[model samples]
Target chain A: GAGVSQSPSNKVTEKGKDVELRCDPISGHTALYWYRQSLGQGLEFLIYFQGNSAPDKSGLPSDRFSAERTGGSVSTLTIQRTQQEDSAVYLCASSRRQGEQPQHFGDGTRLSIL
Target chain B: AQTVTQSQPEMSVQEAETVTLSCTYDTSENNYYLFWYKQPPSRQMILVIRQEAYKQQNATENRFSVNFQKAAKSFSLKISDSQLGDTAMYFCAFMKHAHNDYKLSFGAGTTVTVRA
Candidate 1:
């Protein structure tokens, strides 16, 4: 595809329910990133993947947040037992060749946990 | 840890005027990247400009330019000839020099209002 693509433009789930957000990065991009943005807050880094290896998961707030990238092309961010505070926009971005280039972003998925 | 800071919470500029947005970052690494991104009502974020830490000369993209003071750890963006379309939330971000683990640390965004 020409640009990064994300699924579920908007997702609304119950507080205890689980949800998964998906990201399909630009073809040939090896570095993928996931970020969370709350209302009136900065973009918070969540996870990063380079090729098939993920070296950083320090930004994930708690055990409930997890992300995986398979085949080096698609990634998924899963939230277990979602909390009301989890409501925010989840953004996906990809960089070429291990952060040698600028990151291109996708239209994020806005998740609302009621 | 790398951290970006944008002190001004909100700013307004008249159309056709020039405005400067301030940003400061802290990092021990010598090689890194600084960026300015704009997000309007639409959810997508657009890159405005970038500055490579090695380059002393600031980067310019059309009406957008940056004043990068590496010693001061400041990367401020200057928008020349502001237009109504420039109104958006501006975010300053930083990335380290590490490979396979480059994560962006962003500052609280600044709301820019371009007035007619």
Candidate 2:
């Protein structure tokens, strides 16, 4: 793809339900990232995936938050037992090889936990 | 730990006028990168400009330019001839010089409204 692509642009789920957000990074991009942006807040680092190596999950806020990237292309962010506070926009970005290249971001998914 | 800060929560600029958004960051590492991202109401984050810490000269791309002060730990963005399309939330970001890694630390965004 020419740019990063995200799925489910808007999702409204009930509290305690599980939600999944998907991201398709640019072709040949090795580094994938997941970020959360709350209402009127900064982009919070969530997780980073660098190739087939072990993903850096240090930024996951809680056990309910988990993510996985397959074939180093598409990534999925899953939130189990979602709470109302989880209502926010989930963003995904990918860089060519990381380090120096600027990241390209997707349109993001607006999750509304009602 | 790297932290980016944008002091101004909101700013307004008339069309064709210039507006400067302030940003300050804290990083222990000497070699790093700074960036400015614009997120419009459409929910897409667009890269506005980027600067390398080692470079002394500023970076400019069309109507956007950055005032980078490495010694003072400051990186501010100056938007010349603001337009209505420029109305959006601007975020300042920081990333360190890690081999094949681009993890960014972002600041709370500033909402800029370009009035026509």
Candidate 3:
């Protein structure tokens, strides 16, 4: 893809339901990242992948939030037993590589837990 | 943990004029990077500019420039000749230069409304 792509631009799910968000990084990009933007808040880091390996998952909010990347191209974020507090925009970004390279972002998935 | 702060919750600018947004960060790492991102109503984040910590000279991109003060831990963005299209939420971000530390710590963002 020309840029980072995310599926299901908007999602509205009920509490206690599970939701899965997907992200497709740019072609040949080795570094992918996930972030959460709450209402009127800054983006909070969730996780990142470097060549299909997540070295840092410390930012995941809780045990209910989990993510996985496959073939180093696509990543999925899964939230189990979603809470109303989980309502926010889920953003995904990809860079040519880590370090000083700037990451390109997707339009993001607005997940609303009602 | 690195923290970025944008105290201004909202700002108004006249078209064809200039507006400056303030940002400050706390970090102990010597090598790092600073960035400014813009999010419009479309909800897509676009990189406006970036500055490396080691660079003494600030970074500039056309009408967008940054005043980066490493000692003060301040990185301010100056949008010259603001346009109506520039109305958006602007965010300041920080990233450490260490390996596998690709996560960006972002500020609360300043919403800029460019009025004609």
Best candidate according to lDDT: 3
Worst 10 residues of 2 chain B by lDDT: B95-104
lDDT of 2 by residue, B27-61 (tens): 88989999999999988889999999999999999
Looking at model 2 chain A, which ten-residue stretch has the lowest summed lDDT?
A95-104
Q: What TM-score does candidate 3 get on C-alpha atoms?
A: 0.98
Runs of candidate 2 exceeding 4 Å displacement: none
What is model 3's interface RMSD?
0.8
In the range A69-91, model 1's lDDT, one tens digit per residue, is 88888999999999999999999
The reply for model 1, stretches above 4 Å from the true place, is none
- Candidate 3: regions farther than 4 A off: none
Q: Candidate 3, residues A1-114: lDDT per residue as tens digits?
A: 788999999999999999999999999988899999999998999998888464589899999999999888899999999999999999999998876467899999999999
List DockQ, one per candidate, in order. Answer: 0.82, 0.78, 0.89
Total clashing pairs for each candidate = 0, 1, 0
Candidate maximizing TM-score = 3
Range of the 10 consecutive residues with the lowest summed lDDT in candidate 1 chain B: B95-104
Q: Candidate 3 lDDT, tens digit per residue, B1-116?
A: 99899999999999999999999999999999999999999889999999999999999999999999999999999999999999999999999988778899999999999999
- The CAPRI category of model 1 is high
